[model samples]
Target: MFDIKQYLQEQRQLVEEALRQYMLAAEGDFAAHIETMRYSLFVGGKRIRPILCLTAARCVSDEPDVDMLLLPAACALECIHTYSLIHDDLPAMDNDDLRRGQLTCHKKFGEAEAILAGDGLLTYAFELISSEQFLGLSLEVRLRLIAVLARAAGSLGMVGGQFLDIASEGKEIPFALLKTIHRSKTGALITAAVQMGAIGGGAVAAQLQALTEYGGAVGLAFQIVDDLLDVTSSSKQLGKTAGHDAGQGKATYPAFFGVEKTRALAIEAAERAVAALVGFDERANPLRALARYIVSRTN
Candidate 1:
């Protein structure tokens, strides 16, 4: 039997440790800003993205040392992700006061500093990717991974999603439109995470295709679950504000389909995501578990 919980626990610890290592300490005027940025970056979460990267790398390779090799790259993804959250929570954006069970970055550090901190994290992410440690991979592979990361984080991906999300605010957005928004916003980078791992681990052809499908399915499912949790869960339970989506007049699956249908959709998405990894060996089991956990999580 696959011990999904045990694997997740161990991986979570590894990701947390890696995040701590990635955080740079500031010693001067920007010390407080850096500290606030690090605070949100290290805030407790499941570390899902990095785990997905590590798990995907393991599935297609014979290398047990994949975790050590991919840790920095995985950590860079989190840095980019954290920076997005910090910017997303700004007064001009989601304008929330809480995140990951603590005050939002802008709330803890001034808005200007929070913005710069986010910028700092985003730029630092690419630096980490290009660092000497990750150079163990072929230059071609590293370049490909960097290109993928850049596109996933760029205007055509996450940023474009945010743009549409903001544009759709307070409007009656169609279900299809909402899906398009999420595919770019949440799905693109997630799929990239899986792809990056495969590239980093030297996965070729069919193995890479399977993992990409797996990532795409879960990426959408992740959003569906978030929509469900907004209605069914409490802020304290979620470790962040719940019901904010509806309160903010944002388009969501639940808002259009109702909670019952949305929950069903999440389950279906999760199952499909798991199905995509069927041909892979036991190394893919964690990816399967993560797909299930994404929808099942209360937060």
Candidate 2:
């Protein structure tokens, strides 16, 4: 009997507080750039990645206190994610002015500052993960977590997706190619979040496999929903400009599968995500609920 919303709210507060504390602690010579870094990291978002880490950890164990210890690593993922958004919204990239209902980083702070801020946050994220305060996790576990994160955030993962996106622009794309982009761009980090949570909780092979499967489904579902929202929802409802995908001639689920088929695909992905957690107890209910929320959400 757990209140998933309350748990998510509490964890979001903790992650935000930890992020601010981490940003505030940056004082040695980098004070000027810290504000811009903090601006995007602390800006309003659902904190879904960190919450996924916490919730997945809960599935393997019930140590609520570990959340504080895990906060830095969880926040690291968010930092990388936020950095991607900042760069993605740049004029050279998506040419976007707004994100999450506010001016983009490049808009609020000049493009140069925004680019540096993204770089600063991306590097700082690694520093946080490698810090000594990670609850004395063994080197092997830490190395594995670092590897998972690096691969997901690096050229082989998110970067590859970005490349595919750029290359596919204005071209007639096959559904398979679109799936590859979504899997790499969106699915990798989502998969990494779940893997990191499983690692944080010291999960073994079977549990890790289950969590990975769960993350993969939900990750693709998230992208499909995002594609659908871009066409069906509004900027006000989405908290960012809608139809920007089509406007940019970007390949998307809706563009290829049509809106109705894309919606069905998202629902199917949600069902698969839920099924991935079938082995876990009620401790995993939050993740299951999150899967539903992913598809059901208006924004």
lDDT of 2 by residue, 1-299 (tens): 65667877887898888877765454678776888888888779988888888778778866666556567778889998999999888888888988888899989989999999989888988888888766556678778878999999999899889888989889998888998999999999999998898988878899999999999999999999999999999899987999999998998888877989989999999999999988988888889988877897788
Model 2 misplaced regions, further than 4 Å: 1-3, 24-28
Q: Output the TM-score of candidate 1.
A: 0.96
Best by lDDT: 1
Q: For every candidate structure, what is the RMSD over all alpha carbons to the true structure, in angstroms?
A: 1.3, 1.6
Count of backbone clashes, every candidate in sequence: 0, 0
Q: Where is model 2 poorest over a 10-residue stretch in terms of lDDT?
A: 19-28
Q: Candidate 1: count the clashes.
A: 0
User: Once all C-alphas are superposed, what RMSD does model 2 give against the true structure?
Assistant: 1.6
lDDT of 2 at 207: 97
Estimate every model's Cα lDDT from 0 to 1: 0.87, 0.86
Superposed by TM-score, candidate 2 places the C-alpha of residue 4 at a distance from the truth, in angstroms, of 3.7
The sequence of per-residue lDDT tens digits that candidate 1 reaches over residues 1-299 is 77777888999899999888866776688787678768878877777888889889988889889878888889988988999889999999999998878888889878998899899999988888888766667788878888989999889999899989999999998878899899999998899899999988888889899889998999999999988888889999987888999898999988888988898999999899999988888878888888988888878
